[model samples]
Every structure is written in C-alpha cells, then in structure tokens.
Target: MDINLVLSELQKQNKSVYKNVFNQFYKGMVLYANNFLFDQQTSEDIVQEVFIWLWENAKNIEINTSLKSYLYAMVRNRCLNYLKSIKITDDLNLIDLNSALLLEEDIDNISEDEKAIIYRQILKIVEGFPASMQQIFKLKFVENYKYNEIADELGISVNTVKTQLKRAKLKIGESIPLLLALFLHH
Candidate 1:
C-alpha cells in the first residue's frame, strides 16, 4: 500500500485502513520489541501501544520516510525504555518489601533541577496542544474546575465540556508512550 494514501486515510481516522496498517506492521514490530525486552507478551503490549500512539498522532506525524522504518524505530525506542526502567529499579535496590515501602518517601529526594526539567517538558507538550483543547485542559486540570464550571465559563453545555475534556485526555494518553520514553531516559 502507498504510504501517502495510508497516511491520508489515517488523517481521516478511518478505522479499516488503520487496522490494515496495524496488522501489516504488527509482527515486525513485535519481533523488534522482543529483541530488547525478551518477553513475547510485553512485546505485544508495546507494539499495541505504538500503534495506539500512531493513531492518535496520525494527523501531526510526518511520514516523509518509510512507514516500516518508522515502526521499527518506535519499537526499538520502546524496548530501550523498558530496559532502562529495569535498570533504574535495580539501581534503587527495590527488590524487597522494605525498599518498596521506602520508595514513596525517596521520591521527595528528587533534586530541584530534576523537578524543573520535568516541569518544563510537561509545559512544553501541553503548550504544543491545540489552543482550544489546551484551554479546556488547563481549566480542568490546573484550575480544578468541575465540568459544570467549565461549561458555564465557556458558554458550552456540560456535555460539550465533558467531551472536550475527554478528547484532551485521549490526546495525552496517546502521547504517553513517547513522553515516558523521554522522561524515563532523563
């Protein structure tokens, strides 16, 4: 299939084309994930996550390169992330109940510079979101506004407020794998 046509269909959010593309890529992606993570089930899960991310960002994602290469890259990155997270857990010595219990308190031991870096990345991504969705997200999350409050302020119905917030959350969830890769590495 022509990648441009597939991408166009993706922009339209066509379910059938999306399914076709996912099915075509699934095996290779899983193999790629498995090479690093060495777990078939987790590799399958990671590939599903990659496809979900692709679906969510289809419109914004540039496909100037081959889709196969893109899928390979995503799987490789996710597997590396899985390995790095395992390394972190090992280094923290959280192999026992006692260490697990102390983990919560140790989080506050994060240095100010680390916190600032994470906060800045979060802000950058949020700011990059579409303007209306950004406003809805800020109102819902930062302002802690109820759906009704958001509806009244925007002069939209409560249902509209709810829908917008849901869409905003979906967008964030779709971006999560990528964000996790970046933040976990940092």
Candidate 2:
C-alpha cells in the first residue's frame, strides 16, 4: 500500500482509504503500544484513539516523517501519558489519603508535553547503560517481561536479572537529578 496515496485519500475523508490504512497499521500499532503499556486492551484502545484522531484532523495534519514514525510517536506519547497518570495516582495514595482528592485535580492538570520530555530523558539515560543492563532494563520495563521470563529468554538466572535491573534503576536514579537540572536550565 502506498501510504502517501492513502494519506491523500484520508485527507479527503475517504472511508475506503481510511479502512485500508487501518487494516495495514492497526495490528502493528497495537503491538507497538503494548510494548510500552503491557496491556492488550489499553494498547488497542490507544491505537484506535490515534486512528480516530488521525481521521478527524487529517486535513490539517502535517507529516514530516513517514506515516509509521508519526503513528508510533503518537502511540509512545499516549502510553507515557497513561503511565504518568497512574504514577501520580500511586504517589498520591502513598503520600496522604486526605490529599488524594486534591492530587487527583492536580494530576489531571499535569502537562502531557512535560511528561513526554521526562520520558524521553529517561529513555536517553537507559540507553547509556551498559549493553547487558540496557537489554535487561528494556526487557523488564519496555517489554514488560517478568524477571524469570527475561532470565529464561536470556539464559541467565533470575537473580542476575534482578541485580542488573537494580543496577540500571540506580544508574537512572543517579543521573535523573543532573538531567533534570540541565533540562530546567535550558
């Protein structure tokens, strides 16, 4: 399928072209989203939402990259936003029960762009880890694999998986302050 031609048709609100694009990309998008979200249903929903948005804004949407790249980036940003919302709720629950209501309001007010920046920064840090640690971290977090599953696939012990993940997290934790400082100063 010629993505450019399909995109052209999409901009004209052609259902056949929209269906073709959906058929070609939907499953791949769902799998890509699942890598971040680790939930089949949520991944499908996110991809569906992206397609819906694409259809709604097709006439005004500008694509500087391949359609695949744009779609994947959209999925990644949405997954990060979803994760951040969950994290905020979890943090609020751990901090104070009474403040939960207030935090819920604040959480909804948090900027998605800021979350995407933080997530990208974290990904940069993760990429700088040792190769083995990077693989372990990606398998554990990005791929949402259990320690034992990672160990089995990598032919390593569960303890090794745990130790490597701990090291990776520690490295990320140490670099976060410096990264945030630079980000803020810039």
Candidate 3:
C-alpha cells in the first residue's frame, strides 16, 4: 500500500481512505499499546482515541514520518501518560490511607527523573540485543511498525519478525525489574 497516497487522502477527509487506514492500523495499535499498558480494554481505548484525534485534526495534522510511525508514537505517549496517572492515583490512595491513620510520614512518589532513568535503562537493554532483534524491537515499539511492515522492510518473513520481537520482549521484561530496583533504590 502507498502510505503517502493514503495519508494525502486522509488529509482531504476522504471517508473511505480514513476507514482503510483505521482498519489497517487499529489492531496493530491496540497490540502496541497493550505492550505498555498490559490491559486489553485500556489499549483499545487509547488506540481509538488516537484514531478519533486523527479524524478531528486531519486537515492540520503534519506527519513527517510514515503515518504508521506517527500513530504508534501517539499511542506510546498516551500509554506512558496513562501509566504515570495510575502511579499518581496510587500514591494519592496511599496518602489517604496514611491520613486516616493520623500518621505524619512522608510518601515518596515516582519522580520524573526516576521515570527517565528507567526509560534510559530500558533503552540500554534494548541496545544490548542482537542486531536483528534490536531492529525488530525498534520497528515494533519505537516506530510502531506492524509485523508485515517490519518483515517487508527487513526482507524477512513475518514469522521471523514475530519471533525476534517476542524474544526481545522476554529479554527486556526480565531485565526491567532489576533495572527499576537499581534505580529506585538510589
């Protein structure tokens, strides 16, 4: 598919083109979001929000990269914001619990610096992956490319892309807790 042509049609508010792009990306976006959020419903909601935002701002939207990349980045940022909001809510609940007990202790919330450290650590871990795996991971998460897109770009099979991504996720997941603990303990 000619992504450029599709994007131009989208900018023109062509309903058929919009529907085609939505159909092409919706499932992939949801899956990409679910990697961060781990909740199917929240992932779906975030992807839907992205699509709605695209439709509403189609005329003014300026995408420098492929539309797939832009959409994936949007969903990724939203998921990160959602996670931060959840953390803040949890901290508030803890504060309320302490207040109910009449205790005057301080509660430490996750700071932005800590979040940055965690993100940097994760990126480092990804960098340590094999070249093929690293490329696949970046395409899937960083650029938000679908399996087919990654496969086509790399001249590999879709199954190869999926396998490499799965392996990368497992490796990253294993290291994340240790990285978080190391940073949070400081």
**Which candidate has the highest lDDT of all?**
3
Q: Tell me the TM-score of each prediction against the true structure.
A: 0.47, 0.47, 0.47
Off by over 4 Å in 3: 88-186
Candidate 2 to truth, TM: 0.47
Looking at model 1, residue 89 earns an lDDT score of: 24
Model 3 has an lDDT value of 0.73
52, model 2: CA deviation in Å? 0.5
Candidate 3 colliding pairs, count: 0
User: What's the TM for model 1?
Assistant: 0.47
lDDT of candidate 1 over 1-186, digit per residue (tens)? 799998999999999999998889899889777655545677999999999999999999887689998888988888878868645222322111123221223334444555455344444455667777777766766556788998888888888877876676565446544534453455
Regarding lDDT, does 2 or 3 come out ahead? 3
Candidate 2 C-alpha lDDT tens digits along 2-112: 667867898999998888788988999999987676567779999999999999999988888888888999998998899886552223221111232112333334345
- Which residue pairs show collisions in model 2? none
* Model 1 C-alpha lDDT versus the unseen true structure: 0.68
Q: Which candidate order results from sorting by lDDT in descending order? A: 3, 2, 1
The candidate 3 region of ten consecutive residues with least summed lDDT is 94-103
The 0-to-1 C-alpha lDDT of every candidate, in the order given, reads 0.68, 0.72, 0.73
In angstroms, how far off is 165's CA in candidate 1? 50
